[model samples]
Target: MTLGRSAGGVRLQDVADLAGVSMKTVSNVVHDYEHVSEAMRDKVQAAIDALGYRPNLTARRLATGKTGMIALAIPEIDQFYFAELGRHIGEEAARYGYRILVEQTLNDVEAERAVIRDRDEGLVDGVIFQPARIDTLEIARLRPGTPLVLLGEAARPVNTDHVMIDNTRAARDGVEMLLGRGRRRIAFLATVHGDITESTHLRLLGYQEALLAAGVGLDAHLVLQSEGFGFEDGVRAISSAIAAGVEFDAVLCRDDLFAMAALRGLEIAGRRVPEDVAVLGWDDTAVARYSTPALSSVSPDKQALASAAFALLEDRMQGYDGSGRHEIVAHSIIERATT
Candidate 1:
């Protein structure tokens, strides 16, 4: 049967009439109300599709006081790990009929604060923030009543939701893999020069724990510090360590970029990977699979992290006012030729 449209185009009433349901049912389906039955949702959806009905986002936002948009603020989208995580978040958000507005803070304190401020200004319904330089106190001060979910290794406010893998455990697992492969003189890379971030501190602790467990003495010289977490930073660290006559049979990197760069640096120094020096990286990004001698990596469940973030954020958006919830996603070691 042909469905007639109102002068303002396809309306909720038209879909309701076509589906033989109340307008409330059609509205609930369009708004993704969780209490609606699957059969009713399907029926309303069919009518909506048949009538080519499109939601008026402005009207909906004015009526419901929600924009159906969420901000995903990260340090840098250029980084493989963050980029991959963003992809998972976008996909998961779509499942809930929400759009993601990504903001890159570039690890800048002001930039991170600006994203939170924008969220408070009603540009989006909520925010999923992966902070790099900002602290929990600052975030709490800025966020106020806004719905926010924290990601990454930054300190989580007691009143905010958080989702991440156990960084210390993942780091230890990667180092233990190297130790089991008979790599005694293992070097821990990715130490920064200035103030230590919580992530670096936890990962470094894990590395130390693994060495201690294997009866290997901690070598302060082997804990290499870099200016940044970049390709050149890894190369520079390796070159400096070698020049200083630091002896290490294996390397545990903070990320794939460092691990890949170390491969190049080792090749230049006439060292064979996994033979002369085994290497392990974090975040099993796509590059790890195709890298020469495929890098062994600590792979965090990105999809799970995204799912958990959204679940927590959804609760907050739905007016669940309570203390923060912290979620730890699973992680694993993807061993390959590098180890």
Candidate 2:
């Protein structure tokens, strides 16, 4: 059956003929049906590649009711880490001829719920969600039908794809580095404190583990918690620690912003980085390299993260409705003057 061509363009049957398969088989292959045999799928794909068959996205959308666009919901766009992640996701999406629209949830529960339900009946193909306020139980209940790829640790074990770095191991490594440098009394800055999200909880666990491994006593007073993960929060955290007469020889910040603020606050308190108090940060953002003392940080593979996220989304878009897949990209500790 010739699934009608548009304006002298190749049709589904054209690929079917070239692959020696029926129109339905060609369609199944194009749609990435897993039930199709690998040999048959390969034949159809080879034909598609040889013919350079470009499917008309607009026409296909009219038939399938897809928008060819995806939404990336992050906690906040102002934060350098999220902003940089969005940039990477957008670049990856462009490779598949798809555009990404970024939505800022601002760690608000209501905004996060809105993002889940914003599918609008295929107005957006799917969403790459990085929720902040919503809990795992809430996420399971609010399972939208749209294809979703969850980013970061806020995602639960629902039927979705998740991509993140090894927060616990990375945090442990950073703390161990400080310990190896003969620095004790290391403080954890900008943690959610008590009743935190998985990301914060895992990092804190790793910090405690590191100290315990090094035979260092866990000091509750040395752990400075922050209400939020912002630069000002970092400043307040450091300043408060100083005023409270906390004696810390090193600091492990939650993110680059906190590390940057800690650097400034330490200076204001008549202290020097790596001399008085060595500092370490997560998410080796762009500014990490240019900080006065060139901050040390844990650098997650952003390119690998983007590629994995896009690949998972594409699989979902093509109707791969398997179990929840969690992909872990690699992360490395970037040593610098700060350590």
TM-score per model over all chains:
0.91, 0.81
C-alpha lDDT of residue 202 in model 2: 82
Question: How displaced is residue 305 in candidate 2, in Å?
Answer: 1.7
Q: What ranges in model 2 sit over 4 Å off?
A: 1-60, 192-196
lDDT of predicted model 2: 0.84
Please provide, for model 1 over 25-101, each residue's C-alpha lDDT reduced to its tens digit, 9 standing for 90 to 100: 88888878899999988988999889888777777777699888999999889889999999999999999889999
lDDT of 1 at 205: 92
Candidate 1: C-alpha lDDT: 0.87
Model 1: colliding residue pairs = none
Please provide, for model 2 over 104-174, each residue's C-alpha lDDT reduced to its tens digit, 9 standing for 90 to 100.
88778899988887576676898889987787777768777888888888766657688988899989999
Model 1 lDDT, residue 75, Cα: 83
- Alpha-carbon deviation at 321 in model 1, angstroms: 1.0
What is the lDDT, from 0 to 100, of the residue 21 in candidate 1? Answer: 95
